[model samples]
Target chain A: MIDHIDSKIIALLGKDARMPNNKIAKAINVSEGTVRNRIAKLLKKNIINISLIRNVNQMDNPGIAFVGLDVEASLKDKIAMQLSKMPEVRFVSSLMGRHDLMAFVLADNATELSHILYQKIASLEGVQFTESSIGLKYFKYDYKWGRLLSEAK
Target chain B: MKNNLDNLDIQILDLLEEDGRASAKSIALKLGITEVTASKRISKIIKGDHCKVVAIADFEKCGFEFLLPMGIRVHGKQLEQVAEKISSLDAVYSVSAVSGIQDLEILCATKTLDETVELLDVTLPAIKGIKSITPAISSKVYKFQTDWAPLGND
Candidate 1:
């Protein structure tokens, strides 16, 4: 579990991952060494990952699609595993509702996205059928996980 | 503005994507450029709004146990209003106007089953323009890449 200090550090980093350690220390009222040590610990524990995320809207010809898949009950996990291995697949999750599995795919255009959904995803063993939704506009795609940590028990 | 990122910008992005905390000096050394040049390029990339370097916390570790993906059908021409309203919710991580059966797709993170149920049963339904909602709970997440694919291979 993380303390308030750690949470503050994370909050700052969530805003700008490359924020200087001394600046974060000054903002959070902690020593630079303390900030550095905490971040190192957090990264080592796999509790937080600092990385760069592109704004998908700014890209050209990027097609984003979410696919809901119906698969044989016994092969649900297997099918999810297969989908996870595909480069086009960004997120794959096994579900318990209308769809047994769901995958988020990204491609260059509608044609590429169609090829992925029809030619690749649908051909996977045990994939009964696939329902797809193409993303038109994204109003919010916030990856900052700091605020959520405040509510964590 | 659309990203007019050249080869050098792309390379810097790739390095930062691999290690967001990589120092300008280290990046300069690795890419065979001056530290000042590397620092300026980093600023240009970020100031241009091309991408953001941020820390992503693991949901489970942070006590968010549920990942709820909801398909929402809007009640008429209120798609924009409803999408914007839902986007402001604290639990919602993403809100997208989508094509196909559902008018919008939302991905939410919650701390417990009760919170998940409350979000689906009460909070969302209370919204005026939401026609209907189809919600699913993720049993196991195989992969969730925060990085957009167009920036890198695959």
Candidate 2:
């Protein structure tokens, strides 16, 4: 269980993942060794993933697409796994709605994004219908785990 | 290199991705550069908004039992307004304007199925210009991360 101390440590890293443990220890009023131990445990449990979140509009992945896929009901799980293997496909999820699977795709541009949808995704087996949504604006992209880490445990 | 971030920046990002709290001294040693150089580069990368590092709490452990990738198809010209409203809700971690079936996409999580239902049925219906709402819960997520690479490895 993530007690209040763990919550504070996680919150500090959420602010700046590269923040030194010593700084975090001082801020959270915990020993640096305690912070270190807790982090190790959290990582072991797969409770927290410390990774880089690049800003949008780079040369390679200048375009982002939200592809809503309606796949063969029986093959939803199977197809989702296949989609995950694609390099351009960033995130894959089996969803319940007009679409059976949700794929967050990355490409160089609009044309490339479209190509991925038509050539790559559309051609895949069990991908019955695909509706591609090019991501326009990201009003909110909070990776801070706000509610969970901010308030009291 | 891609965008304003170069190969070295990507390497640093990758090293840090492996260990978010990796020290500049350690990164410098790995990259075969001066510690000052590594720290300076990291500072610049952050200052330029090339990337950010954050703690991604465990959703299940955090008590977010139901994770819904909910889409709201709202009436014309109301997309931004409705999106702004949704962004205010704490459960929502992501809100983006996307093309296709849904005008707005939101990744919102709640502790219980009832709360999620309330978000779709009760809360959203109260909002104006909502034509339809589509909600999908992910049973399995194969890949979910935010990272870019210079050689197109990400």
Provide per-model DockQ scores.
Answer: 0.53, 0.47
Instruction: Write candidate 1's Cα lDDT for A1-153 as tens digits.
Output: 788998999888888889999999999999999999999998887788886878776666788998999998999888987887888888888887858998899887889999999999999889998889999888787677522222111
Estimate, for each residue in B1-154, the C-alpha lDDT of model 2 and write its tens digit.
3466789988987887777768889999999999999999888775565567677786777778877887779899998888888888877878889877788887887889889888878887888888888878876566665564211112
Each model's backbone clash number:
0, 2
Clashing pairs in 2: A14-B55, A96-B136
Number of the top TM-score candidate: 1
How much does candidate 2 score in TM-score?
0.87
True contacts recovered per prediction: 0.75, 0.71
Report model 1's TM-score to 2 decimal places. 0.92
Residues B48-150 of candidate 1 have per-residue lDDT tens digits of: 6678888988877778888888899998999999998998899998888889999998889999889998998899999999989999988888878777622
Candidate 1 segments whose C-alpha is farther than 4 A from its true place: A145-153, B1-3, B149-154
Q: Candidate 2 chain B: worst 10 consecutive residues by lDDT? A: B145-154
Considering just chain B, what TM-score does every model have? 0.88, 0.82
Checking candidate 1 for backbone clashes, the offending pairs are none
Tell me the docking grade of candidate 2. acceptable
- For each candidate in the order shown, give its overall lDDT on alpha carbons: 0.84, 0.76
